[model samples]
Target: MDADLPPLTEALVQDVIYAWCSSAKHEITVPNCGAVWGPEADVVSVTRARLGHEFEIKVSRSDWLSELRQIRGDRRCAKWYRAHTLTNAKEEAKKTAGLAAKGSNCCGLVPPSYFWLVTAPGIVRDDELPAYAGLMEVVPYRHGIHQAHGYRVTETRPAPRLHRVKLLDNQLMAMARGVTLRYWQQRRKAA
Candidate 1:
């Protein structure tokens, strides 16, 4: 873990969620939106299907309200306005509804299917999240990643029912290759 990084528990929770999404073959987008709009908007938007309902993933430890307060601060609040500029709450609600509709149609799910606030253990109490909503609690698990000289390397682990998906920085390079191949394949087919 980097010295400047937030607590290991927090990062671990995020990694677990990332792994879950990866293993499920869902397209994960960071800095998404959720039910609650930030001063900026949402962070970590994950959309899988084309025109599918999207999820806004928020990570918190303790003090969710306090965290929300910080989010309303100048720097963080700027993100919401920067991402969404509809001029009024009505417009924002309309856009949110539209996004939810698209997401539901794409994924064959219903409206307001938001996977909001996956936090570390004990971060959010049962009463914190809404009863009838799609809020989820993601518990963190251990993965064999040894830190050496400011870098971490993942080691082999026992194959469990749910295998953790390991995504390294190099994964982006592989994505580029896949995109290039797809383009050429499509071009050849068309030709």
Candidate 2:
């Protein structure tokens, strides 16, 4: 019944993210771009030239804080950051409040060439992001009988080619799974 429509959830945030990626310029976007048991971001895009983009979508404050805390407390994430850095990953290694950006850095896996924070419109302040990171807003609405999706790019930049190729290769080998499972994988991988 129409009255029983699902409530807005992180799934919606992921859907909005996927839509944005599909329409994004000159990049191939994939949702759940990690293995069935790996840390995955809500969205990952790879440019034709092989640049990697990572996006974190927070539908709730809890989700946002959880991501932040994971970045700050996870030793394995720090280890991955160190490992990727030795390979000369393209992204910069920033130390934010003693938490390394690359240790975020994926919060668990390899950091993308570019990392972005996306949230529902009016949810975050631009000043909260690192200078290199971008912020985006996703707004979904229903117009009478038709539903349309829209997004606002408050700030953004291009992805990195070499890193993107690596992301695509990694996702290709990942076992297919549902979004919920993949999301939990990210949480678990962070710990």
Candidate 3:
């Protein structure tokens, strides 16, 4: 990490993602939506066409590796899906249970159509990423003589559509309601 760089935190990653998602024309974006999506989601977004995107922020290499070990089954990740789909079903199932039981973050969770991994620069490499997930990095940009003006999110690999189905109306409502509820909760805290 650069000595002058701000500490890489989930909040910084989420802010970068919000800017990136908005620039890409997404209509709705929310952070910390365990009620609407999985607890593993650092940020969730919905496009105007109703496609859902999930961003999981990883600030450290250990945290990133830990995440891969937690989310199991073909439903959540393309890499896991491919690996399992190629193996003996019974044997794979046995192994999956042991690995997946290590965490509850993504167990039995249905993934959004698009999934992304966001990190500070150099935390993860492009080849390490799963096939189903996109990669983005928070990088310093707009350099001045002394330092960068701020950080920006840049996609290293675009995420493939994991599924064609748009989010159902009910799911959209749940997301909307989740944001509304979060807003009020924050307001209440301020009061």
Instruction: List model 3 lDDT by residue over 9-81, tens digit each.
Output: 8987788788787778899998877654434358999888877788889999898776666445335574455
Candidate 2 segments exceeding 4 Å error: 1-7, 25-27, 36-38, 73-110, 140-191
Please state the error at residue 61 of candidate 3 in Å: 0.8
lDDT of 2 by residue, 1-191 (tens): 13344444556656666555655563666675564214655676655655566676776667766655554454667424533442354442222212433333333233456667777565555554444456766544434211223332334433233243243333433423444566798899999
How many Å off is the CA of 7 in candidate 2? 5.4
lDDT of each: 0.37, 0.50, 0.69
Ranking by lDDT: 3, 2, 1
- Model 1, C-alpha of 155: deviation from truth (Å): 26
- Candidates 1 and 2, the one with greater TM-score: 2
Q: Candidate 2 vs. truth: CA RMSD?
A: 9.9
> What TM-score does prediction 2 earn?
0.54
Indicate whether candidate 1 or candidate 3 has the larger lDDT. Answer: 3
**In model 3, which residue pairs have backbone atoms overlapping below 3 Å?**
none
Candidates sorted by TM-score, best first = 3, 2, 1
Model 1 bad stretches (over 4 Å): 1-10, 31-45, 51-61, 68-115, 130-133, 140-191
